[model samples]
Target: MTKTGTRNRINAGAWLISPPAFFAVALLAVPLAAVVLISFWTQTGIRDFDTALTTANYREALSDPLYLQLMMRSVWVSAAVTLVTVVLAFPIAYYVSFHVSPRRKPLWIFLITIPFWTSYLIRVFLWKVILGYSGVLNTGLQWLGIIDDPLTVILYNVNAVVITLAHAYAPFAILPIFVALEKIDRPLLEAARDLGEGVVQTFRRVTLPLAMPGVIAASLIVFIPTVGDYITPRLVGGPGGLMIANMIQTQFLRLNNAPMGAALAVQAMGIVAVLALVFVLVLRKLTRRLAQ
Candidate 1:
């Protein structure tokens, strides 16, 4: 094609993308930029703010040990949720992709996503009831002669958060992994077997390596949102389950410290970006080493 024709094509492509790009910038970029600016401002009292630019909010948010602790807790809770979801999801994805009949694969995938049909708030509340003292689990266990008494420790804890988050995010984990597993070349498995490799060896050498991209994708999808989640932590997490998001919520909603809250949010975003980068880099290194 002539340079003029090529230039027109490029312009046409840019024109096609401009609408959504502008829309995204107007909605997303504007709000994020506002938050970044607010994080630098100073708050005098409840719902009162000064236009004076200062780093007081960031300074306090960083130096204050309480917010730091909450941020760390958020990281750990998100990590645990990601780990559990991916681990539990892998088996179901593997089964559906490799064992279930191709004709029925869609049915199984639909079944896995049934939980998403309900409201997320409803899911958290359902877990609250199920795990509450004298809840279904304890009552059923007691009826079955499994335990002597109702376990008070069943709800309002980190374990409960992990279980609920894992369940809520399971479908996200499963879909990516199932897609990856589906794309694996069957002949590779046959080749490994022909070389006399054991089941575990074949998986380690071929299956897992090939499926890792999906696993990493699933982890990032689950982990990033899970870290900023305030609802699950609030409903089922109780005081002990409060994450950085909860603290951020408190600063803005309860304490009327929007600047501080914005600072916390900014810090959380930075931490998430750094953590995601690290995960991708480490995964890439490990996969490279495995290939060697």
Candidate 2:
């Protein structure tokens, strides 16, 4: 209430907030600003500096068929991963939330999260070993007389990319859906049963509607990162499996075309952001209608 006390309180509040604010600017904003700035200028070499601002990079990236195709492929692959993860996770989440005893739920959840405790790169490489020409799958299939020859289709392709990304992000999809399902009141289902609703009808009317937000959240979490992912595609994707991020990498690292690479990065982020916004908006509208 006193002037000195009020001043001290204000200072303390600022101090409390300042660290995070400083961290955000230092870690996020500054790097992002640098990328944007670099995107506008053409690069000649690793050490060469040219500060001339141009739209040539953006124009070339937008107009190039190869880049455009890669971008489309990226979108398609990420969308597929999101869809598959959500569909698979929903049933698991449903079973865990409704059917399992509370005492054992944490154990099941921990098992679900166990894969995440392992190194991601190691897990991915393990898939490579399993899916390779002389890998366990091929060897087993051959021994079982299921296949006469090694299958090259499993290692480096869009299918491999989808499989890897889906596995990697599956936990992300599950947790949100599980949380949403757990938050639902049990009495709602009981009330539905009391009103003579069938099991499928109750789920359709009560459970699915309430779980839309989690579905949206999970889809965004999986899709957005998958779209921007370079590692999975690099490790699993063959020449034909190259996505937009791969192209961006080549532009920056191999081609030494920083401006073009930056343009591609910016474009990828922008497109994903717009799609995410649209998804969130649609989900919000649907949630409102469901509430009504």
Candidate 3:
């Protein structure tokens, strides 16, 4: 090509890529950079920003039992939600992907996604009513003489948080698994069957291994959001339901300690990132072995 033509092509390629690059830098990278910078600084309760840099926020967060406890609780709760959602979603996804007719697959997938069209807060509030002492479940149970008094144990606890999150994120878990399961060739299952493998053995050896990527993807999606979630715990978790996100909110808004809040936010993000990395690495290794 001529020099001018080559130059024109180069400019066109740069123009095509520049907008997204600029948007990412402006929207994502810059904000993340600011948060990292602020995380290293110090802030008094009265001011929003402090120019002084210190390790006090990180130290305080690490040393404080309440913060540490909340962090651990967040991890555990998120893990539980991810596990439940994955376990429940996998079978539904598998059925829709492999067992159902192609004509019916879209319908089943559509039904799976119907819950997401509603407001998340409203859905959670509905659960609150169902689980509440004077709510439908309690009323029904009392009428049937299933129990004498109302059951307060159903709401305002870690279990409530887990249940709500699991329901909310189930679709997220299902879709990825469906995609992975759908990608598997039918002949592979036939090959296993032809090799004298039983239904359970074929599934264990062929299907589950093929679906690991989706499992990892779904788990990360549910787990990451659950860790950073403030709403589910705030509304459902009365006292023991508080997570690290709650503390981060308090520091940022109530105490006006932006720097400290940023620090805590970074700490939480770092922990999640590390865990996600480990999960992805282990999943990739397993996938490689399965492929072999």
Candidate 4:
């Protein structure tokens, strides 16, 4: 093609993407830029902000022990939720993708996503009822003579937050894994078996490596949003389960310190970005080593 024709094609492609590009900038980029900009400003009074740029918010957000504790709690809670969701999801995804009949796979996937049909708040409340001292789980276990007293550890704490978040995000974790497992060529598994590998060995050498991409994807999907999750932590998390997001909420609303909240939010985003990057890099490296 002539340079003019190539240029026309490129221009046409740009024109086609311009609408979505504009929306992305308007909806995502602009808001994010506004938050970052606000993070550098000073809160002088309730409903009052100094437009002059300052770093005090960032310094306090990072250095304050309470803020640091909440930040770390958010990180670990998110990590725990990610681990549980992915681990449980992998088996379900594997079973549906590898063992279930292809004709029935869609039905199984649909069933797995039934949890999403309900409102998220409703689901969290349902979990609260199930995990409460006098809740279904405790009552059932008591009836079965498994425990004489109600369990207090499972509700209104970090455990509750993890359980609720894990359950909420389970479908997100499962779909990616199921897709990855589906894409695995059955012939490859057969090849591994023919080479005298056992079930565990074949999976370790072949299936797990191929499925790492999905696992990584699922981890990121669960980890990123859960860190910023405020609702679940609020409803079921109690005082102990309150995360950095709760503090951020307080800063923005109750405390009337939007700048500090923005700084905290930016810091949280930075931490999540760094951790996610490290996670992907490490997982990819492990996958390469496993493949080799």
Worst 10 residues of 2 by lDDT: 283-292
Per-model C-alpha lDDT, please?
Answer: 0.92, 0.90, 0.90, 0.96
Q: How many backbone clashes does candidate 4 have?
A: 0
TM-score of 4: 0.98
Clashing pairs in 3: none
Residue 17, candidate 2: alpha-carbon lDDT: 100
Per-residue lDDT for 1-292 in model 4, tens only? 9999999999999999999999999999999999999999998988788999999999998799999999999999999999999999999999999889989998998899899899999999999999999999999999999999999999999999999999999999999999999999999999999999999988988999999989999999999999999999999999999999999999998989998999999999999999999999999999988877
Residue-level lDDT for 21 in candidate 3: 99
RMSD per model, one decimal? 1.3, 2.3, 2.2, 1.0
The window of 10 residues in a row where model 1 has the poorest summed lDDT is 283-292
> Please, what are the lDDT tens digits per residue for candidate 3 over residues 177-254?
999999999999999999998998888779988999899999999999999999989998888888999989998889
TM-score each candidate: 0.97, 0.92, 0.92, 0.98
Clashes of each: 0, 0, 0, 0
Best by TM-score: 4
Model 1 TM-score relative to the real fold: 0.97
Model with the higher lDDT, candidate 1 or 4: 4
Location of the lowest summed lDDT over 10 successive residues in candidate 4: 42-51
